[model samples]
Target: MTAISVQNMNVWFGTGALRADAVLDVSFDVNEGEIFGLVGESGSGKSTILRAMVGLVPTWSGTMQIAGETLGKKRSQAFFGNVQMVFQDPYASLHPRHTVDRVLSEVMRLHGIADVDERIVQLLDDVGLGAGFRFRYPHQLSGGQRQRVAIARALAPKPTILLLDEPTSALDVSVQAEILNLLADLQQSQGLTYIMVSHDLGVVGHLCKRIAVMKDGEFVEVLSVEAMRRLEASHAYTKHLLASSIQSVS
Candidate 1:
């Protein structure tokens, strides 16, 4: 089952003289419960692709479907509940004044969900946070802990599809590994479908079953991990990126 499908998607910021293309003719399908990686450098439109799918980039002209229902700007109430996003910056994503308890509860209240106390506690434990931390403010936690809170908030609604944009980019090496392992474990347990936008090849290699490499607002290559590992010097840009990412680990 395809959880999301995109066809001929293009996003333009301006019209006429100032027209600029952010994404061009992007197309792909995300299988149910599978992690699909969109890997590319900054300004390559990977993030734009995600925004389009979730109906945030309304200027786009294309076809996008989530869970068999097509999407558009100002999504219906049902669309909002089915899809959720975990942004790159945990610091910016969470509210400063709100306690973690208030943060998670707001969503449940908005959706008119009853009996949320037990659900919130279970969510905290699932994200590796104890109930003790639930009352703390965003400033009270470390960077990694803050990210776990962000993940918990995203999962609070029990969304079927998650749009993860460089979810581990701001974390330390050890913290990154822990978050990655947690995401893998969560996906396996819940059968979640993930569309991850990242520049880290190693991260993609570890989590995604298939990857699409974007360049100049287009997908220049889509290949399996085995094919990427066998890439030659002929693919100058791909080779450079792969080598740089490998060196980053070493």
Candidate 2:
């Protein structure tokens, strides 16, 4: 089953005189329970695709479908309930003033879920934060802990699809591994689909079965993770990226 389908997607910014294309002629499908990766350097429109899907970037033209239903220009509340995003920066994404408990509780309230207290604790536990971090502020936790809270918050609404934008880029090397493992576990346990955007080919190679390489607001190539691992990319741009990734790890 296709969890997400996007065709001929274009995202533009600015008006007539100052207009710019952020993403152009992009298309792809992510299967249910699959981890689909978008990889490229900054400003390559990897994150723009994600922002467009969630309606954050409204200046877009294309057809987008989530779980076989056509997505309209204006998303309904139910649409948001099925899809959620976990941002790159945990500290920036979370509300500094709101405690962890309040952060998770608010989502449950918005989703009309009863027994907020129990659900909040369960959400925290699900993300590996446990109940101990409930009353803590974002300042009190480490980067990894804060990200776990962010993950918990995104899952509070019981979303089936998660859009992860550089989810571990801000964390420590050791912490990055933990967060990645947590994401993998969550997807397996919850049967969730993920659309992850990152510049790190190593990270994507580990998490995704398939990946799309984006360049200058368009996809340079779409290939399996095995092709990426074996450095067998056909496109010149993709081969360049693979070479760079190999050099970075060496």
Candidate 3:
């Protein structure tokens, strides 16, 4: 089943004389329970695609069909109920004053989910935080712990689709793998669909079978991770990126 279908999508900022395209003529399809990756350099418009899907960037044109429903300028409440985003900065995503419990509880309440108390505990556990971290404020948690809490909040609504925008980029190198493993586990246990955006080719390659490479607000190539690792790319930019990734780790 196709979970997301996008075609001829164009995202821009401003209008008329000042109009600038951030994403242009992009298209793709993601299967249900698949983990799709979008990778590119900064300013390549990778994050804008996720933002458009979640309705944060509303100035987009063209087609966006998610979970079989066509999207318009405004998203329905039901749309949000099925999709949630985990931002790149875990520290900034959570409220400084809110405890983990409140963060999760509020999301559930807004989604009209019942048994909030029970669900909070389960969500914490699902994200590998357990119940002890539930009452700690965002300031008190470590970066990895904070991200887990953020993931818990997103999961509170039982969303089937998760938009991950460099979810592990802001964390310590040692902590990155732990969070990645946790996400993999959750996806397996719950059958979740993921759309992850990252500049790190290796990160995306590890988590996603296929990836779209972008340059200057357009998809230059779409290929499997196997092709990415083998440095086999039809586009020159993708070849450069693959070589850079190889050199970075060398």
Off by over 4 Å in 3: none
Model 2 TM: 0.98
User: In model 2, how large is the Cα lDDT of residue 49?
Assistant: 95
Model 3 C-alpha RMSD to native: 0.7
The weakest ten consecutive residues by lDDT in model 3 span 67-76
If the candidates were sorted by their TM-score against the true structure, best first, what order would they fall in? 3, 2, 1
Per residue, candidate 3 scores C-alpha lDDT tens digits across 1-250 of 9999999999999989999999999999999999999999999999999999999998998998998789997778888989999999998999998888889899888989999988888888888889999899999999999999988888888889999999999998789999999999999999999999999988899999899999999999999988888788999999999989889999
lDDT of each: 0.88, 0.93, 0.93
Cα TM-score per model:
0.95, 0.98, 0.98
User: lDDT tens string, model 1, 1-250?
Assistant: 9999989889989789999999999888889998999998999999988887777777998888888788766677767778888989999999999999999999877766777898889889999998999899999998889999999888887889999999999999899999999999999999999999899999998899888988889987777777777764345677878889888888
Q: Model 1: clashing residue pairs?
A: none
The CA lDDT at 83 in model 3 is 93
**Candidate 1 or 3, higher TM-score?**
3
Q: lDDT per residue, candidate 2, 122-236, as tens digits?
A: 8888888889999999999999999999999899888999999999999999999999999999999999999999999999999999999999999999999988878889999
Task: Predict model 1's lDDT versus the native.
Answer: 0.88
